[model samples]
Target: MTIAGSDSGGGAGIQADLKTFSALGCYGASVITALTAQNTRTVTMIEPASPAMIAAQMAAVFDDLDIRAVKLGMLGDARAIATVAEGLRGRDLPLVLDPVMVAKSGDTLLPDDAIATLRDLLLPRATLLTPNLPEAARLLDTTPATTEAQMAEQGAALRALGPRAVLMKGGHAAGPVCTDLLVTAAGITRLTAPRLPTRNTHGTGCTLSAAIAAGLARGLDLPEAVALAHGYLQRAIAAADGLRVGSGHGPVHHFHAVWPHV
Candidate 1:
């Protein structure tokens, strides 16, 4: 299940998660917690779905589907987060969480109260928590991470907050190589790739987390899943390097390999 807000632009949030899941050969499902009037350039408005309606959607999915894994995204407010958390209790499934605090256009997706509930309830239940440097700093209530060593340290600190593992993404940091650190109760693993110089990077966090959910549904171990998902996103970005969509940053081509007859 992809629990997220709907992006009318079809580039991020639920749209991106479902596309990534399907491209990775998994059946996709979703429960929208909110709807955004957004595009690559900006989020003009947000209308959060009521908590009751959100719960109903989740119940409908769970009652009918054999959900093996869950990819969680934008929960609009504290009530929505609490509702999702309450509904997910006692389910023995792999939960891949992308701490989606902000949109690519720099709009806040999660409210302050929701962030607290997420750290307390949802983070502990996550099989893997994926957070970019900025989100990690916000979660840990510390200064923004500026170095690889700080990334690793924050990864460890975030792991202590309850998730079984943490994927600390370094894409927002300045570097020749984008390093992603996966820290588990078992050990730490680092995966790096040359940063693709492209504007087609919208929905990257959603794509990565959804890819990890697809990997988990396909029965990969945590480290292996994370490593493969990182590679997948890197390739997608490179393949979309020259493609243009909106006037602002475009989205990574989900069907890059299959389309354009390259």
Candidate 2:
């Protein structure tokens, strides 16, 4: 299940997550914490769901579905974050938390104040916390890492904060190869892939996290899940140009494996 915001553009947030879950052969469920009036170009407006409604949706989903794992994204505000934290506190499932603070178009989705609330309440409970360079810097109150060493350092710092593990994404870093560090208490495993040239890279973060969650749901271990999800996103990004959904940074192809060549 994905606990997130809804993107009307059918790209990032809940839409991308659900698409990823389905494409990866998992039954998808959702609890919307907010709604965004957005397209690939930019986010124009955001309306957070009331705490009651958010809680209700979570309860309803947990009440019936035999959910195995969860992916969290775009919880709009402190209230929504707290509500989600409360709903997930006692659940014994793998939680893939994606710290979604900014959109591909450079719009801020999370406010400055709410970052504290999220770190305090949700960080400790996550099975895997995935944060891009900028989001990681924001969470740690430091500048974004420019090199792999710094990324490993930041990942260690974040792990010390309480999550079981952290996946430090290096998409923001400048290089021909994109490297993602999977940091655990023992050590860090660097996963690298060639950076594909494509402007349609929206929802890349959401899709990766959701794919990892789907792998976990299918009984794969952390390393296995991360590997599969990493490869999946690489292919999705490589195929992203086939889609002409929008004028700006468009979405990665979630159904790259299943859909006929575009």
Candidate 3:
């Protein structure tokens, strides 16, 4: 289940999550929390669906589907977060939270007040929390410097926030190699890949988290699942670099290696 908002551009929010799930060979389901008039260039406007509507959608999905894992992306406000949290109570399922606070175009997807709600309620319930550099900094209330040590330290701090594991993504940092550190009470595992120079990075975070959810649904452990998901996203990004879809920063091709249409 992908509980998030709709991206009209079909890049970043629920759209990207669903594509990633399908690409990884998992049945995808969604419970939309909001809708945004967004493209590769910018988010023009946001229309948050009522909390009751969001809850109803989740209930409907839970009632019908045998959902194994849930990938949560953008929840616009505190109420939306609360609604999802309330709906998820007592379910023993893998919940992957991609703390999508800011978009690639620098728009704030989650409100300031909603951050607290996310930390208080959602983080504790999540099986794994994936946060990029900025999101990790916000969650830890510290500036993340460009260093591997700092990344691991921050990842550890994020893990202490109640999630079973925390993946601190290093894509936002200044570096030649991008590293994502997975921290848990057990230990830290680092997954490194060469950062491809490309503009088609619109849905990277969503794709990574969704891929991890797919892996979890397929019964992989936290460390193994995150490693495979990171590798998959790296190849997807490299293959999608030059394929232009929209005017501005475009999306990574979800079906980069699938097949040519008939």
Candidate 4:
């Protein structure tokens, strides 16, 4: 299940999550916490769902389907975060929490005050937290990371926030290679891939976390799931330019290697 916002562009948020789940052979379900009138270029407007509506959607899923894992994306505000936390409290499902704060087009996806609620109410319940450089920085109230060493430090700090592990994404890093750091109680490991040159990276974070959720649903361990998801994201970025969806930043091809590339 993916608890996220809706992207009318179908590039990121719940749209990307469902595509990723299907590509990875996992059945997908969703609870939309907000709705955005957005395209690949920009988010024109955002309207949050009522807490009651969000709860209803979650109950509609948990009450029926035997969901294996959950991927959380853009919760619009504090009430939405509280609603989801309350609905998911005490459930032991593997949760891939992608701290989605802003969009690629520089639009705010999550409201400011809700950050505190996410930290207090949602972080502890997460099995794994995936935050990019900026999101990690904002969550910790520090400067964003720009190097592998810095990312490792940030990953460790994020793990201390109560998630079993934290995956600090390095897409914002300046380099020929992008490195993602996974910090767990077990240890820190680096996953690197040559950077693909493309502006069509609109939905990468959402896709990667959703892929991880799909992998967990299929019974892979966290490390294995993350590794596979990383590989998938790389190919999706590589194939992104071929897709001419929008005028500005386009979306990565979630189905690029659906038959298996790595």
Name the candidate that leads on TM-score: 2
2 versus 3: better lDDT goes to: 2
Best by lDDT: 2
> What is candidate 4's lDDT per residue for 1-262, written digit by digit as tens?
9999999999999999999999999999999998899998899999999999999999999999999999999998899999999999879899999999999999888767889999998998888999999999999989998878888898888887889999999889887888889999999988999988789999999999999999999999999999999988888888888787899999999888653442
Question: Which scores greater on TM-score, model 2 or model 4?
Answer: 2
Off by over 4 Å in 4: 258-262
Overall lDDT per candidate, in order of appearance: 0.90, 0.94, 0.89, 0.92
lDDT tens per residue, model 3, 38-127: 999999998999999999999999999999999999999999999999999999999999999888888889888889999999999999
Displacement of residue 179 (Cα, Å) in model 2 is 0.5
Range of the 10 consecutive residues with the lowest summed lDDT in candidate 3:
253-262
TM-score of each predicted structure versus truth:
0.97, 0.99, 0.97, 0.97
Evaluate residue 2 in candidate 3 and report its C-alpha lDDT on the 0 to 100 scale.
Answer: 96
For residue 126, give model 2's deviation from the true position in Å.
0.5
Model 2 has an lDDT value of 0.94
TM-score of 2: 0.99
Between candidates 1 and 2, the one scoring higher on lDDT is: 2
Error of 3 at 34 (Å): 0.9
Q: Which ten residues in a row have the lowest lDDT in candidate 2?
A: 253-262
Candidate 2 lDDT over 1-262, as tens digits, reads 9999999999999999999999999999999989999999989999899999999999999999999999999999999999999998779999999999999989999999999999999999999999999999999999999999999999999998889999999999998999999999778999999988888889999999999999999999999999999999999998888888989999999998887588
Q: Candidate 3: what lDDT?
A: 0.89
